[model samples]
Target: MPVTSIVKDPEALSLTVHAEFPVKVARLWDAYLDARQLEKFWGPAEYPATFTRHDAAAGGRSNYHMTSPEGEEFHGYWEWNEVVEHKFFEVTDGFAHPDGTPNTDLPVNRMVFSFDPTPEGTKLTITAAFDSAEDMEQVVAMGMIDGTRSAMSQIEQVLIDLRNYSQTFATEAELVSDTQVRVVRLVRGTRQQVWDAHHDAALVKRWQYGPDGWSMTKCDLASGIGESYLLWWAPEDGGQGFGFSGKILERVEGHYESSTEQLEGGEEILGSGVPGSVNQQTFTGTTGGTLVTTLITYRDKAARDAMLATGMADGMEASYARLESIL
Candidate 1:
């Protein structure tokens, strides 16, 4: 939890938030300026924000909108007034229409965020000053206190999980459950480019090979749900080959896909007797690159452990490294 306390003062016409984090002051400051990290916690969990434009310099502006679970969007912007690196910044936070025009019916607040270093970590203090008592009360009535707390609660994960979101990091796998795991990679390419690389036969053959000496011999892909696909790889020195055959269970264009996958051949393959897995993949665009998340659900814990013990993560990293060069 990044936020420790929230104070609302009626007579002072101000709302202040105090949050502590066990990170260097510079790292904490960078997370706010980076749009990728900001979007993760800038809005409430139900209404995640997307920042189409974020300018960090003084006198610059940031344009963002949050969409509710019901698909309604609320636009907002910030006019940066002053910035002192690793210390504090001032901004005018306001509500806006979908067209980027200010909504005069609502109030804009002057906000100053101070960052201080302590023996343990960094402490962030945010003071938002309102023009009138009525305006301050209005925002509080709109669940501002609860919403702010909910937004800041997510910051701890972003600050701690550096490898998961960093573009330069190699592909990694995270355990989701006893019978499930998630493989993630931040690849340098547009979502469409990454999608095409997976679907195009020639491109797939070029990089999907796990490591040197192995080559993709078959790359039959399915572009629609219910269709079947086949992937096979073999060694250059006439070594035994292995492959996976599955049907596309779900397809959402360049955004998401899922299928049932199983190992078919190759005596060298580990956990060959275990039942296969269902893999669902999602592609999300970020400021640095595209985040590819593949969730694999196996038949049981034994099967999941077996697959991971086969050096699967390292193999995937090698392939992703190849993908980086081509893209």
Candidate 2:
């Protein structure tokens, strides 16, 4: 479909605005696929929105509500079907009363999102088709264009900030510097699934380690200090052992504490003679699933330098991609 205006009938009393978001395909896919993220910055001017009863499958039902600052509430729902991640989704949207009564005048839109990667970024084109000209015009005049533009602007900045943080956080010298690393990913799955992936050593071995034939050898799940694990990365190419040996320096169980250890260095590797600081992993439950956080500290300059020199950013990104795949 062509990227056209949402103003269905400008000569009539109503018009709707359409927007195109030039964003990274992965980020855009996350924005749509992750419901928790939908609740964050989904609307313009902080218009709070909640996604309720979302199944995100064919013949399933989902609803959304936008509450204005002045105590006004707008409710809508969709008979969700034909979902293809980062490709397309069709929904029946309308004026559902706060009490769940549907209004027929509002249109049910077939929304399509296509991602085309280019040198600049992914061209995200979102198109919605309304039933009639009047319905299209009504939604258009409600600031759909400006609202979408603002929300997408926020999304673009968010991606940029995340990429910047990934580089700066890894290469920085100070352990607890002026800014700490923060994870804002929206993990989609059941709580049990997320928790299992997190605490299970086998799953961690698959996701946390690099793809060059790496695996976890040991883990201690004690609730106190001094618990530790050794992740052994023995490549099949007859490469030497290269891995991180971590020990719990402090304990907070479910919340977060500190894991201090050292990255072993071989002839091709460089281990930090100084303590490699601590890694604080925090897990929190959300409506859809769990949010996992990892904050690593490299207090020593040499440690940070070695990791960065080995393409830390790419490695970290690959690790995250693996994690997503596992979950």
The prediction achieving the highest lDDT against the true structure is 1
Quote the lDDT for 257 in model 2.
Answer: 46
* Number of the top TM-score candidate: 1
1-327 in candidate 2: lDDT tens per residue? Answer: 122354444444333343444555555555554444555556675677765434455565555677789968788776755666555566666668776567665655665555666565566656666666666666777767767655655665545444433222121122222223333343555545655665667787777666566544444344457766666666666667676677777543343345765666544554444336466654434443444445555665665555545655466656656776776
lDDT (CA) per prediction: 0.82, 0.56
Off by over 4 Å in 2: 1-23, 161-327
| lDDT of candidate model 1 versus the reference | 0.82
Could you tell me the C-alpha RMSD of candidate 1 in Å?
A: 11.1
User: How far out, in Å, is residue 122 in model 1?
Assistant: 19
- Give candidate 2's TM-score: 0.45
